[model samples]
Target chain A: MIEVKKLRKSFDGRTVLHDIDATFYTGKTNLIIGQSGSGKTVLVKSLVGLLRPDKGEILFDGRNLLTMTSQEVKELRKEIGMLFQGSALFDSETVLGNVMFPLTMFTSMSRAEMLDRAMFCIERVNLKGAENKYPSEISGGMQKRVAIARAIALNPKYLFCDEPNSGLDPKTSIVIDELLSDITHEYGITTVINTHDMNSVLGIGENIIFINKGHREWVGDMSQIYTTSNEALNDFVFATRLFQDVRAYVAKHGKI
Target chain B: MILTNSLANFGRYCMFLTRTFSIPDRWSVFGKRTIQEVSKLGIDSIPLVIIISLFIGAVCTIQMQLNVSSPLIPSYSVGLATREIILLEFSNSILCLILAGKVGSNIASEIGTMRVTEQIDALEIMGVNSANYLTLPKIVAFVFFMPVLSVLCMGTAFIGGWCVAAFTDIIPVSRYVYGLQTMFTEWYVWYGLIKSLVFAFLIASISSYCGYYVKGGALQVGKASTDAVVSSSIFILLFDVILTKLLLQ
Candidate 1:
């Protein structure tokens, strides 16, 4: 589990996230949802240590991640995994090579063992036939799966994915979402996914935090989301006509 | 204010460099990376360097022959002049300048692309010291391979000059060979090699630094690549002056 207390981050005197606090539980998909430039990216980046919060306490299993020494930080990071928005597979390496990278870096596994483990991960992601292909040769959805395979290669206790479903079709997005949800439950990992996709929020978002202008506005699960009366959250969530119609129907019916 | 910013950037770069050369997590991994970098930065660069060096040597001989037109001067001086220029400047500084374009920009673009794409972040989150894993291998590779490249460059240039001298009849082959033998001090070889080593480090270090800290998207990556090549060339020239003063004096 990860606990963030009073987190704040700013760039060039313009504050991005302030007074943000949330708890991401193990074995659940926690989603941070907001519009573009709404500070969700900054917040997630801070959580992952890519950006340093101006003031905050990020407790990973009750240890302050903000104050750890360099060596300790690296050791702490071994239990952490991140899937970038673009999937971020090394362009030079094949799918198998990309998934095998973390193991090659952090493990004492022999070459044969490493290959076996990498093969297992590729198969687990349902990418068995695409092992030898480069990331460029695969679809965006497949790249995300490769990224997921690489992320879980170490069996990390914590997983962070940034915009996991962006640029993917609806069908592929659902597949990726289900994969992430399944993996979170299967591995019992504290998984935090940052996204603005309302579909993702309604689908796999077991716990959700809505940020508007660096402030946390509403916090709850998908089930509560459809029924929430928070005006700003409603504005952002139901901005589209289709979602607004769903909201009206749900309101009339009293459930989604 | 600009001075202050520049100084701050320099400090940050120095700190990054310190982190880049730290002890590896696994020597086997590092060794493998080092060998790959060596092949890319050194072995792969051989043909281009050879072609450039040969052409440069040929031109140097012809230019010396044209300018030293006085019958009073020995034909051997043409060979001597070509030898001196090739060894001192052409082989080390010129070749490095050329490679600043070839290899430096490559390092910058690659690292910059990775940064923009979040590959570096992926490495950091994995607990891999990204700097050490990525840049150190290239640095070590350049330091070790550059002297070998300098030797090859110098050898090719000298032979090219010899070929020009023999074919063009600017100087007889026997006389040109005699001129090469006349005052062939060993220290010049060492001097060219020392310069190559320093230039190699600067190229790899500056280029990698630019790439690693790149911001924004593809445009920024391209900007970083340009900055790397430009910075590397400027530093190579500046160091040439400083090293020339300190070493030769």
Candidate 2:
């Protein structure tokens, strides 16, 4: 489990996060949803030790990440895997090489063993035959899958995905979300995803935290999402065309 | 304002260099980045180096043959002249200019893209020292590869000069070889090698720094790449002059 305590972050005197606290539990997809510029990315980055919080502590299984030495932090990093917004695969390496990178860096596994592990991860992500292809040669959806394969190669204890479905089509986005959710439950890893995709929230958001203007506006599961009384969240959720049509239908039936 | 800022930046850069050197794990990272950067920098730059060195040598020989008219200065002395010029100025300065355009731009753009894409941040979060992991290998590669490339450049230029002299009948083959063997000093080769090492350090450090500090987005990375090549080229020429005066004295 990842626990964030009183996390405060500022940039050049402007506060981006205001004492936000949240817990990302294991074996579930915990979603941090907010509009652009609402500090969702900053909050996730701070939790992962990519950005230093101005005040607060991030405890990964009771060990404070910020207080750890550089060496200790690196050891802890072996347990964490991150999927970047743009799939951030090494352009120079083939898909197989990219997936094998973490294993090569952190483990003394033999070439055959490493290849087996990498191939297994690639097949797990459903990218079986694209091993030799470079990132530029693959489609955007395939690239995201490759990134996921690379992320899970080490079987990390914590998984963080930043806008994992950003550039994909809706169908592909759902597939990616399901893949991540399934992986989370299968591995029982602490999974935290930063996204504003309503489909993701409604589909696999076992636990969701909504941030508005750098403040945690709500924290609950998908069941409580549509019924939340918070006007800002209501405006956000009901602003969707599908939800708006449903609202209009309910209003016409005098059931709103 | 620029002067003060530049001075402060220089101070900060010096501190960064010192801190980088002081780290205990510097050698390990240097070894890794060296192998990576050498294949990317040295092996990739060979064709351009050969083409440029040969053509420049041929041109210099033809020009020298056409311009000089002293009987005391043998017509075949063009080979020796090409050797001296290539070893002293052309290989060290011109090759560095080419690398600033090629390798320097590549290093900056690659690292800058990594910065914007959060790969560097990922590395940092993973407990890896971004500087040691990214920059040190590049520095080691440049330092190790540049001197060897300089030697190759010199050899190619000398051969090109000899071929041109033979074709143009500017000098007899025996006289050209004699002039090359007798005229040039060992110091000149040493001087060029020294200059190549300095040029490599400047190019790699500045280019990597440009990439490392890139902010904003893809646009910022493009800007950093341009800045890296431009700055590295200018510094290479400036340092060439300073080192020439200091060492050739």
Candidate No. with top DockQ = 1
Most lDDT-accurate candidate: 1
> Could you tell me which 10 consecutive residues in candidate 1 chain B have the lowest summed lDDT?
B176-185
Task: Quote the lDDT for B168 in model 1.
Answer: 78
The TM-score obtained by model 2 is 0.92
lDDT of 1 by residue, A83-200 (tens): 9999999998999999999998889999899999999989988999999999999999999999999999999999999999999998999999999999999989999999988889
Top candidate on TM-score is 1
DockQ of each: 0.84, 0.53
Per-residue lDDT of candidate 2, residues A170-205 (tens digit):
999999999999999999989999999999999999
Pull out the clashing pairs in model 1.
Answer: none
**Can you write out model 2's per-residue Cα lDDT over B1-249, one digit (the tens) per residue?**
999988986886676566445453435435665787899988889999999999998888777767765778775566667677888899899889988999998999999999888778766655557776777778878889998899999988888877876786776777767767876699999999999999999998989888888999989999999999999998998998899899988
All candidates' chain B TM-scores are: 0.98, 0.92
Query: Which pairs of residues clash in candidate 2, taking residues 3 or more apart in a chain or in different chains?
Result: B33-B137
Once fitted onto the true fold, the runs of candidate 2 whose alpha carbons sit more than 4 angstroms away are B11-36, B71-80
